[model samples]
Target: MANFNEDGLKKKLDDLNMSQQSIQTVSLWLIHHKKHAHTVVNVWYRELITATDSRKLTFMYLANDVIQNSKKKGPEYNKEFGSKLGKVFEHLGALRLDEKSLRGLNRLLNVWEDRSVFDADHIKLFKKNLNKGHGKSKENNSRKRELGGKHDNPQSKKRRDSASDAIQPSTPESRLRRDSEGDLTQFAVSPQSSTPPSDPPEPEQLIEAIQELENAATSDALVREKIANLPDEVSDVNLLNKLQDLAAGRALCDQVEEALSMLEAYNKRLAEEMEARKAVARMLHDYIAFQKDLLAQAEETLEEHRQKQGKVKKVREELKAHLQNLPDISKLPSIRMGGLAPLPSAGDLFT
Candidate 1:
């Protein structure tokens, strides 16, 4: 990725196109360096102002992609772009846009309004300014056409119209129009993976699994105690000296065999418990990763809420200040009964 500097950003903008891949690639890079969102937005606006009319819509699309997608990760891009979008709309609106360009711009505005990407008031103001600019441009074009028509010879005008019609079929703008229309269609359909995402493990299930591992080796306390207190005679041959007869020896042999069987059973249980522990370890690792992702998402949401609260607070304060500065309505002079001139009588009017 290129460094998030003004020069690097300008270079990227220069290469930007209407293709979904191009816009998304640039959006991802911008979102990655969201800490520099302020600089990025400034650079974007400056470049957009200088960009040709054909490229202006592409810049808007890039901004839209970044603002919408970056919200899940952080609000930096949205905040920065939100502040500058009004001016962006005004600039684009002032240009002589074709039908397709105007339609594309309207579509973008509708999407933002529907998504509530910005406050309703802001969106309304943006749309108003955009229309105002376009209206001004239309008026100017209308005046120019009227002025030109006054001096245009009928034969010359006909020839010029014919020439325009002949050349229109081969114009680059026509090709761009087709390509951009396709690109816009593609952009509208958000990309998704063919495979659906797997859900995280349930908290209850995870807790139960962990709890089961607590006594996985042996849940039988008595058996565990008995194993711990096993006699040494089971493994010691020297104890045979204490045997007084064949019956005693046989009894010792029986005790040793029982001990051996118990130890073997315990060993097998321990091996199974170890395997269970390994599986639980893997599960815990995945669960922890999933939890961290959730935590990050939550933090992003919290930041977005804080930004919204701050905006509302600021607006409220401004309104309060504006109200305070207004003159009191009650202190203004009031009209008295004789303040107005008397009306003429109906009889006088009839006479």
Candidate 2:
């Protein structure tokens, strides 16, 4: 969380001796891929750039700044054409962030960065990333410090001594006397004590410890047995009952393992049956589609036949009318009955 923001990055970038054209090319590329660049940097960009050479570091900062500032939409936005020209330094390879920077970029493809709208899957993934970033090593060291295994600072040591001096040792008689008074506040830190009271442990820390213990018990037989025997020392009835229940559950699980195997087989068979039914349903759907197509073709053929029949009937009617309109040869003329006079003899009749 150093001053790795845009201004700081740009200042670093200005220190590099890259050519203007190369820088402009890089800037244009970043501008073209601004969205992807933003997403890549937001999640996986390390705050620290560990480069041996100052030039390389400058280039990295340059690339980082260009990507970061691309999303600004106000007056301060980089409106200048060559504003991201420092990007050319990335070609040196040293300017590139680790390839692992791609890890969280894919997660942002469809995810809204706003925490409020996260679904269960998104929340789960966010928690996983959180756990990855703040891993068990930090928690382990914290626990070691809590258990007094870590070296204390001189000031803390003196404070602890002062607090210890303020507390009084209790004997059975003193305990009985205090019990008679029914007052427990007497053991509280005195107001005049120079040492400040330690802050109460966070609920999250307590929950993490409980989960670790539960996981240890489940994973290790020795730890499980130790937990089962814990009630002997604590002498808490509720704790004992819970331990008994846990043991009973473990025993029951072992007893039912064969049954679980049978159930698994049954489930597998059921899944297979369901898949088969789905396949059959798909085939049936295809068959129905094919039948529908055939029916459509048949209907089209029937329509064409009907059209052709109508055309044939029209033609027949026209022919019949034409035939009826024609004059009757018997009424029109009897060639043999003499519609004209006979021809005269060629020579004598003429004279």
Q: 1-351 in candidate 1: lDDT tens per residue?
A: 234577888887898887645565566567656778999999999998998888888888888777766766668888888889888888876778775566556656655765687889997887777777566454343323323343667664454333222212223443344232122221222322110122234567677888987777667687799887887777878887878999988888898889889989988988999898877777776566545644554576588679999999999999999999999977765556465566789998999
Candidate 2 per-residue lDDT over residues 14-75, each given as its tens digit: 43333332333333334333334443233222322333343443343334234333434222
- Candidate 1 residue runs with Cα over 4 Å from true position: 135-351
Q: How many residue pairs of model 2 clash at the backbone?
A: 0
* Residue 103 CA displacement from its true place in model 2, Å: 62
Per-prediction backbone clash count: 0, 0
lDDT scores of the candidates, listed in order: 0.66, 0.38
lDDT for residue 168 in candidate 2, whole number 0-100: 22
Q: Estimate candidate 2's alpha-carbon lDDT, on a 0 to 1 scale.
A: 0.38
TM-score of 1: 0.42
Q: Residue 167 of model 2: what lDDT? A: 23
